[model samples]
Target: MKTIKVSVVTPDGPVYESDVEMISTKAQSGELGILPGHIPMVAPLQIGSVRLKNGGNTEFVAVTGGLLEVRPDQVTILAQAAETAEHIDLERALKAKERAEHRLNEVKQSNVDFKRAELALKRAINRINVQKRDF
Candidate 1:
């Protein structure tokens, strides 16, 4: 079996680096699946989970919108924020989800940024889903 080198990075640092047989993630346009010898390209990512399959196991990384660069033998995700399933704090994600939901429900408030709250809710849900390996 062959593998591709995958690296998930953020402004803070790298979140994941490994050799994977397949990679699945959500892009702004749609979902993408990459293999070891995938065509080189670039796409904007959405707030979602990145699934890396290797050795009959799948690992998950939660990304908060960024850019994905794919090469024949390598794939790099430069994300604004990223966290692996093992590192995601479930309690914190739940709290963020709650806060975001609260903000969204208060749409009549002038101070509330609906779009930002919606994005936050998406990110929070993404983290929770990734941590649970829902996909």
Candidate 2:
């Protein structure tokens, strides 16, 4: 099987580094997928999960937002924040999702920043959803 190198970096440090048979993530325009020998390009990634596949195995990573650069041999992700499924705290993520929902609901009456609340909600949802990926 063919594989491509993948590295996901965040503010603190690199969160994931491995060789993947394929990868998929949400891009600003839409969903993006890369395979070995894919065309080189740069794209803006959105708050969502990055899915890496190696043969029958798969892994998921939650990303707040980032930039994706794909080369013929490797894919690099420079993210604002990232956590693999194993590292994510389900309880914390559920609490965050609730808080974001509450903030979104109070945007009008509480003078909450609508855009900020929306982004937070999306990020929280993405984190929670990443936990649902099946092995």
Candidate 3:
């Protein structure tokens, strides 16, 4: 079977490195699916799930802001911060969502880390979305 070498990395370190049959992820432009031997491209990724297909299975990794670089032979994801569904805490995600929502509601715009809070909320939601799927 044809396989694409894929890597997911953050400033902290590498999150994943494997040979995937295909990959699907949310990009700023839109959702995209990448298969082996795809045309080279570079795109900004959005806050959502990175789907990896291996054999007949698919895995989900929740990613925050990132950049996806698709090359003829490999694919790389450089995420700001990311987490897998297995590593996520639904309760904690809920709490973060609530906290971000609350802060957005009452905090003064100047003093708030609006972008950070928003990104957190999105990440939490992404976790929920991936966790809900049957894989």
Best by lDDT: 1
Return the TM-score for each candidate structure.
Answer: 0.97, 0.95, 0.88
Residues 47-104, candidate 2, lDDT per residue (tens digit)?
9899999999999999988899999989999999999998988888889888989988
Best by TM-score: 1
Model 2 residue 34 CA deviation (Å) reads: 0.5
* Alpha-carbon shift of residue 3 in model 1 (angstroms): 0.4
* lDDT tens readout by residue for model 1, 33-84: 9998888999999899999999889999999999999998899999999999
Residue pairs clashing, model 3: none
**TM-score attained by model 3:** 0.88
> Poorest 10 consecutive residues of model 2 by lDDT?
126-135
Which is the better candidate, 2 or 3, if ranked by TM-score?
2
Residue-pair clashes per prediction, in order, are 0, 0, 0
lDDT of every model, 2 decimals: 0.94, 0.91, 0.86
lDDT of 1 at 42: 98
How far is 58's C-alpha from truth in model 1 (Å)?
0.1
